[model samples]
Target chain A: MAIREPIRTGGRSARVQQSIHRAVCELLATQPRESLTVPLIASHAGVTPSTIYRRWGDLPTLLADVSLERLRPDTAPADTGSLHGDLLAWAEQYVDELGSEPGRAMVRDFINSGAACQCSNLLRGQLQHITERALQRGEQAPAADLLVDQLAAPMVYRVVFSEQLPSTAQLKVWVARALAR
Target chain B: MAIREPIRTGGRSARVQQSIHRAVCELLATQPRESLTVPLIASHAGVTPSTIYRRWGDLPTLLADVSLERLRPDTAPADTGSLHGDLLAWAEQYVDELGSEPGRAMVRDFINSGAACQCSNLLRGQLQHITERALQRGEQAPAADLLVDQLAAPMVYRVVFSEQLPSTAQLKVWVARALAR
Candidate 1:
């Protein structure tokens, strides 16, 4: 399925969305996730609950919208001149970003929103880009799905389900395993 | 940390617990997850909301408790005469059980519950048991952690995040990959 896009992109509709998103972020910083409600967020954002309900449908969907916005990659993957170096650099950065407490919270929101595949696809696209670059350079590189299986899946599982995040050393092992013939 | 046990495991407390759990399962079968609230569950179970809150802490925790109860394996992994056959059979069954719609909902609850590590450890224990059995039979088996990293993680990531479930063919590939020298 195609990724869900914002219903409105400009003018007053965009401004309302921005304010609502900002309210959620601010509330999350101070309050526990369970305490958050559409009525509370609407009040904080100076809008009515009906407005939020009409636009976002529910709290999970709204949280998903906010999380996807935050998770969007702002820049391309780094160019390290080799597939091994590039994958290592990318995997290291990925772990550091997603392994953080707030990042894990975003993952929880994405998963609970029932739109987790959208986030997965975003991550997969970046891995595919990296592999394509390696293929262009005639350097050996693993398929993107293989990277998802060997590298991303384990890292995500650790971050979301395990008590400890995957260490940098573990990230190295995963990158090596993915690149291994 | 040890798994959380029931505050009271016998008599009236046990009866109340059973009633509450049954109510949750029944409600879940009929109502959307988002529509479920402690008060609603209490009304259905013929108890007070405070009783649930005092016992389970919150909705997510209660959901997690219900999910964990449903997820506990009733029997040991099948004995297939060889490590390869055993792993293959186990992975196939794992995908089938967890890939279903209801199973996926349970996974979302576990992830949102802040107690996901408990579930992961349970799965790890089962994998270790399988590996130990292989070792006893003098068959070479991959380490349990390796199986988790390669087989469990990929299957889980797909089940919880992606739209498509991993097929039996894919389970075989994961088993082969995990067992590869």
Candidate 2:
């Protein structure tokens, strides 16, 4: 089936668009994952349920989009000469941001909501790419990319699962382990 | 207020009787994370909701016990003599089991349910102990423990977040990477 994209308008769109997205997102961050319903979100957003259903078919997919939108990683590669340095800097930035209120809320939302977001899948790809680049620069032994995937992804999971901001020490440990393997 | 202890029964003083425990576990394995409610579980178990509530306080706590009861890691430390062999065995056993059908279902339940299950907190602790043991087995590097947490934990998270099971090769890659680091 051909999917028709929603049309954008300057005046009408402006009037309703920001309010709709803001309403959806605000309710998302504030409400319990289970309590999140189209009607509830609309009520919270000050719009009708039709408006919400029109934009995002169901609550799980909408929540997935919102959650994914929040964790869009900084894609620019860090070429700071040393692999360890680049990795540490990236790890620090990643951990630092994830350790915040928004990060916690996002994690909590995933924990509470039964919906599994596609963000993790996307992040896995990104993590793999970055790990490859970092390894090449470091002149480390030819480590398999899949190995990097296994070695590096779990710390982020632990942080989210435990809802604790990992210290820099954890980042160091990750780098050390990844290189060692 | 002092936490009320479970009444002694079945010769063990376990609050949740063994039959009820098995029923609750079976529900978590088969039911969708969000669909796991008192009435659903009770019906599945051929028990009344009142009985379930009397034995267990609520859905979340009941769900936690359901998942937690079976996730205890094989505490038998691998004595393969080589750190690599020991870790490989642990990763294979741990990852395979974690990615197994029943394991995935319950955890998916835990994640989707917003971790309302009281046992979610305990599950996190269990993972830590398992990881700590793996790191402690390393011959030279003392901090492989940190490495394991930092590197491999995220991939496991990725698996839980996704509905698909991770392949053994993928798991091996993750463990291999952790070993190198």
Candidate 3:
């Protein structure tokens, strides 16, 4: 009487899997940080824990995929034609993003398990690249990473520990101060 | 009669308890992070499991105090007559101390239990005071906390996450960059 949406027929199953995967990530984004366990993740995707466990094997593996899914590796480099301008733009973007609910939740999740997630490592790599780019442009400073760390650390601490987001004005002031160096 | 050190009391019972507490902390510092437990802590501390349980109530409380005892917050904030200089000096001293074996051990301990510590409220209060001081100096900006976060976060992160003591050059550069604004 009616044609049915194909169920579990190779390509069909892959498509369905893709759809469910996206939903799982979407749910993670929308939910509170504390509720991101396997049970919840499966429920959010309209699947069973067996399905999830079979697909990802463990929480860390699942988390690694979800967190890095939309994270393109192109953080603003230290070169908006000027080192200061570029760093400021990076700072502004970093601060604004971190101020949001999702960003705050992401930070808390990373900090909670004694930083068992690979997210910190990923973020640290991005920061390292930003510094390296400056070096490539012939800027020399021994404490560049320290300077960057100083500028970036507070937002994370506030997000993960204190549950507050950085204000835009504060972000600007911080960038202005760091660039002034 | 023997004169016992203040750390361990005269009576045999007191002596046993002192050895046990010290042993627990030492094990946490030296052993793999995964090996921490009531039994492990008690065994290392040279006391019975009952004594360890009775005193600490749980792994978290005992771990918390022992971890706190390991940090040396430089009491005398160096006054190089200016905020920038003082901060740099402080960063240098802190990083140097953090580079030591004991410092590393303490940091590892904290990183492992950071979630269980619940010190966010305390951190917020301290941030408030720092903000007030900045305002008093006629240098208040919207992102003052962010500025502070950037500066402090890197040091904490590097120690807890990377297992590397940030170089002095890094600290100096960071302070210089931060105060430039």
lDDT of 3: 0.56
Give the Å shift of residue A27 in candidate 3. 7.2
Instruction: Report lDDT (CA) for all predictions.
Output: 0.86, 0.57, 0.56
Which candidate number would show the highest TM-score if scored against the true structure? 1
| Local accuracy of candidate 1 as per-residue lDDT tens digits, A66-135 | 8898888898899999888888888888888887777887787787677798899999999999999999
Top model by lDDT, which number?
A: 1
Rank order by TM-score, top first?
1, 2, 3
- lDDT tens digits by residue: candidate 3, A1-181: 1112224646855665665558767876587545668887777677888876776665645554544444545644545755555656776676666667665444433433334234556556666666677678887433454444655666555554454666767666655554443
- Give the chain B TM-score for each candidate: 0.89, 0.61, 0.56
Candidate 1 Cα outliers beyond 4 Å, as residue runs: A1-3, A7-12, A25-36, A43-46, B1-3, B6-12, B26-35, B43-46
Tens digits of per-residue lDDT for model 3, B80-122: 5455555666667666766666555554444334432344443
TM-score of chain A of each: 0.87, 0.62, 0.62
Question: What would the per-residue lDDT of candidate 1 be over residues B42-133, giving only the tens digit for each residue?
Answer: 99999999999888888888988988888778888998988888878887887887877777777777877777898998899889989999
